[model samples]
Target chain A: DAGVTQSPTHLIKTRGQHVTLRCSPISGHKSVSWYQQVLGQGPQFIFQYYEKEERGRGNFPDRFSARQFPNYSSELNVNALLLGDSALYLCASSLAGGRRNEQFFGPGTRLTVL
Target chain B: GESVGLHLPTLSVQEGDNSIINCAYSNSASDYFIWYKQESGKGPQFIIDIRSNMDKRQGQRVTVLLNKTVKHLSLQIAATQPGDSAVYFCAETWSNDYKLSFGAGTTVTVRA
Candidate 1:
């Protein structure tokens, strides 16, 4: 089976612009989560959706939002992007929402804010 | 505030040698601990995980040891190989929570 997959592996945006990244979870997975990874740092959780419902959210600002589809695919959107928003956006999928399930990650979309 | 942190920023080891990486977490309520390996330009891969009920867990050639008393966690790789070179991160989360808190990763470099 294929792992989690993401689209537009690379993106470049300008300050004050908006960008959207997409993720397709593994087959039979029900939960999808988004994380932002800065250079030299670990991934920071952004949002988690289970069964198409928002189950968790991280410390990110209002500019960041995400939603999951019925098929378990997810989209992460960033509005009014800032230079600080430049990072790799990762998507992970799991069988469920809680800690009992191990998450499988995607290759991630590298967002560069110019 | 709960947080997870690593003891070292980097570790260099020779091939066929053993490697150890350490992490410390401040959340005593966290019952699940996981280790992830991330290569450049890719997402993290699950290495191993342990629950608070157990002190140790092993997977393939890797081992994860947990010490709840000191809130410490360690990952040990036996006969490390060059393919093991990557940034390793330790994450913690409670059974009731949906989020996983990650620490600053430890970069492992295996030399041939």
Candidate 2:
């Protein structure tokens, strides 16, 4: 089966602009999560949705938000982007939304804010 | 302010040799730990995971050892190959949490 997939592999935005990234979870998966990875750093959790409900959120600013669809796909939106927002936005999926479940990740969408 | 962290920033291992990467976590409540491998321009791939109840777990040619007493974790790869070259990260989360906290990764380079 195909793994988690993300869209718009690359995106460029200006400061104060808004951007949206998309992700589709693996078939039969019910949980989707978003993470941001700065260059040379590990990924930082942003948001997690399970069964189409908000289950968890990270320490990111209010400018970052996410929602999951009935089909288990997800969209991550960033508003008023800043240069610090430039990084790879990753999406992961798992059979469940628990910490014990292993998460499979997507190739990620590279976002650059000028 | 406690978070997961790695002991070494990089490691170079000869082909066919064993490789070891270490990580330290400060959250005493963390019960689940996972190791991930990430290549250039790619997302992290889960390698293996071990619960606080277990001290060691093995999968394929990899072994994860956890020492709760010191809050230390290690990943060992047997007969390392070039394909194993990548940045390895250790993440932790407690039973009640839904997000995984990751550490600064250790870059592993396999020398031929």
Candidate 3:
């Protein structure tokens, strides 16, 4: 079924630079979410979009944002990246009808901000 | 400021032994809870989930127990194998919405 796929399996950026990571959800999924996992910590929610509308957001700074395309794919953008921003950016997708449903995750993009 | 958290940072068990991983969540409004397994360089994969209405749910070789009284959650792995070694996390969702909060995660290592 192709599952979930993420782009730029790895990325290296300098501090203060902007970065964009992409994700393609599995077929028949309507909900997309973004999460950040710092080293030795669990993933923290960033944003969730359903039906192309923002459904939820975490406590991340305004510099972090995301949008889901009409096709259900999503992109996560970070502006003025900091060293702390160097973490795994994960994308998950699921059916939106069943109470948010069970999210299937992609391998994620390892972002390293130098 | 209350969030999902784990009791142990790491757990090591011999193969074929049963293992239990525990978590605590603060939000009483949390109606749905899930357990996810993550491997090195990969994202979290849903293992099993249980709702507040139920105290326990069982899947393949795993079981999830939820204790609303203590705001606690636990994942139990039966007859653990090396493949079962990974970081396990527990997450809770607010009843008013589906926003999820994950715990710090427990690393499970199965000894051969």
Candidate 4:
């Protein structure tokens, strides 16, 4: 079975620019979540979408947003990016939402903001 | 275990030796815990999970122990190998919010 897949493995952008990262969830998986991992840090949750609807959100600012499609693929959008946003953007998919959710993660897209 | 240095904590262990990495959680209400291993430029891979109901869970050569009385968690690997080298993170999940709060992570380097 194919694992979670993310697109645009790497990207570079300047401050105040916009970037969108894409993710395709595994087959038969309906829940998708986004996380940001800086160097030497753990993955920080951003947004979680289930059945094309957002189920939960983390402590990120308003500049970060995401949506899930009917096909279970998702996209993460960052507006007016900052250098601090330079990190590995990871996409994870689980069988369902709610408690005790075990997620399978993608390789992650490395985002560089200059 | 774990330390609060600017960099991730590093634990070097020789191959064929046993390894133990520890984590202290802040919340007492956390009922579920999970350990993940992340390699170079890769996302975390789930190692094992244990609930508060039990003090330990074993999978293959890996074992996870939880001490609710002290809010401590540890991962023990028997006969450690070079492939076990990675950043290990412990996460806690509460019943209220399904979000998993991750630790800073401990780097385990299995020396040959």
Backbone-clash count (model 3): 0
User: Model 3 segments beyond 4 Å from truth?
Assistant: A97-99, B1-6
Considering the two chains of model 2, state its CAPRI-style docking category. Answer: medium
List where candidate 2 sits over 4 angstroms from the true fold: B1-6
- Check candidate 3 and list the clashing pairs: none
- The predicted structure with the larger TM-score, 3 or 4, is 4
lDDT of 3 by residue, B2-89 (tens): 1124598888888998899999987998899999999987889999999999999999998899999999998888889999889999
Model 1 lDDT tens row, A28-94: 9999999999989989999999999999999999999999998989999999999999999999999
After superposing candidate 4 on the true structure, give the runs of residues whose Cα lies further than 4 Å from its correct spot.
Answer: B1-8
lDDT of 3 at B104: 89
Ranking the candidates on DockQ from highest down gives: 2, 1, 4, 3
DockQ for every model, please.
Answer: 0.79, 0.80, 0.55, 0.69
lDDT of 4 by residue, A29-108 (tens): 99998999998788888988889988889999999999998898999999999999999999999989764778998999
Error of 4 at B28 (Å): 1.3
Q: Among all windows of ten consecutive residues in candidate 4 chain A, which has the lowest summed lDDT? A: A96-105
Cα lDDT over the full model 4:
0.89
Query: lDDT tens string, model 3, A1-114?
Result: 698999999999999999999999999999998999898998888999899999888899999999999999999999999999999999999988234488999999999999
- Give candidate 4's error at residue A108 in angstroms: 0.5
Model 4 residue A86 CA deviation in Å = 0.5
